[model samples]
Target chain A: MSTQIEQQETETEADEETEPEVESPGERRRAQRDERQAIEEAQRETEEASLDDENTITLKVFRYDPEVEGKQEPRFDDFRVPFHKGMTVLDALIYARDHYDSSLTFRHSCRQAVCGSDALFVNGKQRLGCKTQMSELDDPVRIEPLPHQEVVKDLVVDMEHFYDQMEAVEPYFDADETPDDKLEEQRQTRENREKVKMSTRCIWCGACMSSCNIAAGDNEYLGPAAINKAYRFAMDEREGENRKQERLRIIEQEHGVWRCQTQFSCTEVCPKDIPLTEHIQELKREAVKNNLKFW
Target chain B: MAQHYSSFDRGGRRWLFQRLTAVFLIGVLAFHFMLLHFVNHAADLTFLGTQARMSQVSYFATMWLFLVTATFHGVNGVYNALVNQGLTGSRKNAVKYLLGIAGLLLVVQGTRVSLAMTTLV
Candidate 1:
């Protein structure tokens, strides 16, 4: 990939020399310097691209097999993909598989942000590959698997634990009692609906959970995503008094609301703008108030 | 998930009592030291001195308040520190509940001891 990038640069340089120079001394010198700087930056970018750059999008995928490896040291693999207008990191990965190496693996579905698949460490932050455009990033976008998760393969993280924590909260709502058929539509205040509407928007993407430092050491923690799940129902007026108290009890467990340290990372990374910290704080207040009533 | 399980949960009350007692003891201990050591030294102690202080109901009340606050504060602070260190699971919960019951008993006994020391006895 480096040789190809070098070859492309030399060819461009040779083409520049062939063209007749024009303009005044000052203008020509500045233009030449700018052109040289641009070429150097492009070359430097390609070199830094894959951890190995070629002339294309260099992807440095980290590989580790916890079971098969002797010492389990991570290594990067390189691939140069043809650049396209508005090409996404996911698009580049797909192109790498079709052309260079078929074994280069990653996850994607729906090819849209809604599926919550294709979340990779694009540079140093968690981002959905389908949503991040290649043109918006420097050459050879450094694609690695998400951190704090067991990688099943190249880019696919084992989401079983994430799923289990989510399920433990029983994400499905259990209403107090069915509304009478005589009164088909249940009435709710507009203010109450809006208050919990943000919490209800959580997609269970586990993006917030992965960023939380608290969840890193404690496996018992229900995590921000699950706590937000509890908040959704707990704050909902439609759930009624019986179900509301039940939701509160779930969140009031030892590994629940008290576990949150108001870190706000959960709120920052929530794709749906769920206001996770605010909801967790409210749950903590609810827990405190519930205790005080006994006095 | 159960209804109002937090009522019996002792986490918040311990947190509050520890902080409150720490604040109270700062003032009460300073006042008690000045009165006991410098203002009315043990060399000048007498039944007249004891009667003079205890007869004033406010002074007797303050003495009991200091003891009750210090006992609850010191014991509950130890409990909160243990809990914040990842105390969970059934066995830990059993120990926690036992500690809570023991703490309540201590508070009851300590209050009685403080009342007995005061003129209220």
Candidate 2:
């Protein structure tokens, strides 16, 4: 009985008003229905918005420094940032530091994602701080340094290891012959670039590398980010056929593609929407294919 | 060559068995609860009462089944959970073997208790 009454009320809310004069009965009825629907949707949206606005958020930022005395141990600092229209957690961090304390440190360059800095652990997930909007964050956003690496400073991890892994993959196109015209860029088919375009989109953010559990446990493991880098160059037809075997050999190393345990963490954290695990798995298939051919 | 063993990994299989054992244990637990709380006329529990039940073939089978399933489910599930939490290399292998031995000992000891109750041994 209560359910029927509730349903009736819901229906009444759907078709409550009509702004435009309707001469025909069918059009009048539609306008009335649309008005009701718009009113109901508006009411629902307002209710949802009020619920979200009522939620006051607090951010807990981890503080640590190798040089600072008296505070040898790592600790967390808490800040309450007021939520506003289209505000992001990165904006909140900036707000906190500028308004509250100058000592709070983080690395951010080219506030846009083109530079790829400001990746950090926001609520136990690796996310690009600049790109992640704040309203989406659950109350008490717990910010920490990216896991599975030596922290050089707050939110600034040593990228030398990541660079080494990327370099190890030989991330350069190796074509034996120079083009007839040295000035002209080499012609690549549209389809060829499309196949490996996603792999090339990696900005070396290191989020995928940090999220991987296997890479954390085993230091030598060529993390997902590196393997994807290799894929970008290797899969490019422009690199030529002569280098394919060498590229395969690079990925087939003991600490290479085989070490990935496929926990799906790398895929989840990638901001560029790069399918890191799929690329890694495809490389494994390629490596195995080469091995079978050799036999 | 290792064949792909269904979608269930070692951890997933253990999880499935843990749920299965829990279901089995519920029936056994009910029987146990009824025998102790309702069937037994006296309030006190004795070794003789256990022996009397174990002496029956049906009771012996039920007890042995319950004991084996419970130990395997409980111990293996624990080991699987540990492995999922990043246990690898020799340390992971060592825990695997240690837990194997512990599980074997428990099953043997538990089976003996059931045997002593029924004379089925």
Candidate 3:
């Protein structure tokens, strides 16, 4: 009899808790319609805003930050940016950084292609961000850091090694003698300057180095950029025969021009369109020709 | 930049040799292939036919040169490939010695085989 009385008490408590609070169906429908209308109106406003200025472009940007807890895991963030005629990938990145996420990190100084600071893997090809047109790329353009490079952050690679390799070639012009007259410059023939004109256009972008399979495999290999740097001075008649011979000796090391397998990847990806393979091949021939003279 | 101590320290000699041997091999290999497969039927080969070609001093000398060049080219190509893959230090030395031995053995054994074929005449 005590157990039965406890069960009755529990039932009475359950009934009190289950009491209904009701609304009319018409009122609920009107509220739902209002919410839908508000969402549509907002969508319309966004579309009008987009139409007011320009068409929208989708950019899938690679993101990673070891310091931030949320960004520790690498992910791609999509940003819908306004597209203008002749707009470049760098411009889109800037727009996204300024309007969407201020924390987006990338290295770009001069908007012009001269800086070589913005070499990126866009659409599976190495290209300068400031030079690649948005219209030329397919929709939802994929942009990532250069391949075969250690990414310090989003779209930024550690260029220390590349700079080191370039320096290893002693890229500056070294001459044994100054002009006899203080006011006069060292003379170079028109043909010689034209020969090295493309080679001299290297902005130290590291694009050709990054694109080289040999450079990726052999750390010691003087990459196309560095070898081309050597070529610039080695071929210049103004540097004299001794300096040219020294330059050739430096590049003819085991890890120098011989390491190049004629992959043409460096030439293919060079932003300046420098003929890296041709230069390397020419150096090989020159080295061979010089060695034959000794025999 | 590091200075090469000896006249041979620069890789120019080896690189030039590789190219020169490549050009020679291309011509010799093509000639050998055309002679064996196209000019003469490969299926009709006999011991006497082989001895007949080996008995000629020019043919025998060319075959000897071919054997030497082929060994050097193949061994050097492998060494270059290994170096390109970042082989260095003791590991590179090991590959160097091993390839050298292999090439020497190949040339020695190849010469013995060539002599045996000629002696049968």
Candidate 4:
């Protein structure tokens, strides 16, 4: 694609040389720039015209702004984007922003699933926009901010609450004691790492929390990502037994893992393919066993 | 966040009991249905036949235990559902006590009715 654009730029430069020179040097340069812009405009128009319904995809994006007078009321805007084989929902959104409405707004960073910044409600499901292929979705795709979260603007939802829940679990690993030697490493067994491996894959995309029905209804529920974070540290062998017990108590609280209905919505929407519900269940079982030991 | 120090308030005990009762209910429910609908047949049910079944100490004890567990399971499920719906504060306490009283009344009435069916009572 970069090569194609470069070829077009060179061709436009060659065409500029053929024009008769009458104006001053600076004026000529300005005239040449204007002509090149007009040519680019015409090329774009023709390219768009040729990109019939078959070659273009339609995106209906949610628009909202509490501060903008005309845009205060939420609405959906449609943009026609030229489609390519590997184009994703995020690609279409970028095209719409660049070529159509510069005011179009959304959150995205790496343009990959790793950033976990582009989670959106696409076609009635929680998904990462950068990870969802345009071809996999139906045409006239609908995109909105993740549900159960307060919309900040356009496709951006307030993620402060989600971050709070994640922090509530104290996601960082705290070991009981360090090795006597400064250079000694606190290594984990292969089996122990494997046990907590899936739980450690949370990208904090907030998709699982948005997809959970119970989380939607219960404002106090810790939700799946937080429980998975707790699971990650609680199951780690290096963490002290006291730390593990504290983590278990946190998850076993009234609004913690017990609130999960095992609906599998979190697991289904997770971009990392983390078995979230299973981890929550494991935590519940661990909590129960700890209590039984006392009994 | 509410700090839970005791096992009673941690929510784990009720969660475990709910699962335990659910497992017990599944088996006992199947047996109850099979006994009533398949073996005895609804058309063949009579007061005397019910009395004869209730007269056996083993069967009577099982039925009573089933009633108690079923009440706890059903009531606890409803309570949990309410809590998950963001029920809180005094309203949540009200619902908790109301549901508890209702469950107790149900078990007591159930036991009395079962005793009325048995000659030993």
**Which candidate wins on DockQ?**
4
Model 4 residue B76 distance off true place after TM-score fit, in angstroms? 0.4
DockQ of every model listed?
Answer: 0.09, 0.02, 0.32, 0.54
How many pairs of residues collide in model 2? 7
Where does model 4 sit among the CAPRI classes?
A: medium
The residue ranges of model 2 lying beyond 4 angstroms of the native Cα positions read A1-56, B1-121
Best by TM-score: 4
True contacts kept of each: 0.02, 0.02, 0.50, 0.58
Q: Rank all candidate structures by their TM-score, best first, as comma-separated numbers.
A: 4, 3, 1, 2
* Tens digit of per-residue lDDT, candidate 3, span A46-135: 654655324888899999988888988889999888888999999999988976789999999998889899999998888999999999
lDDT of 2 by residue, A224-276 (tens): 98899888877878777668767766676646676676788999999899999
Candidates 2 and 4, the one with greater DockQ:
4
Per-candidate count of clashing residue pairs (backbone under 3 Å): 1, 7, 0, 0
So what's the TM-score on candidate 1? 0.61
Between prediction 3 and prediction 4, which has the larger DockQ? 4
Lowest lDDT block of 10, candidate 1 chain B: B1-10
Say what the RMSD of model 1 is: 11.8
Better of 2 and 3 by lDDT: 3
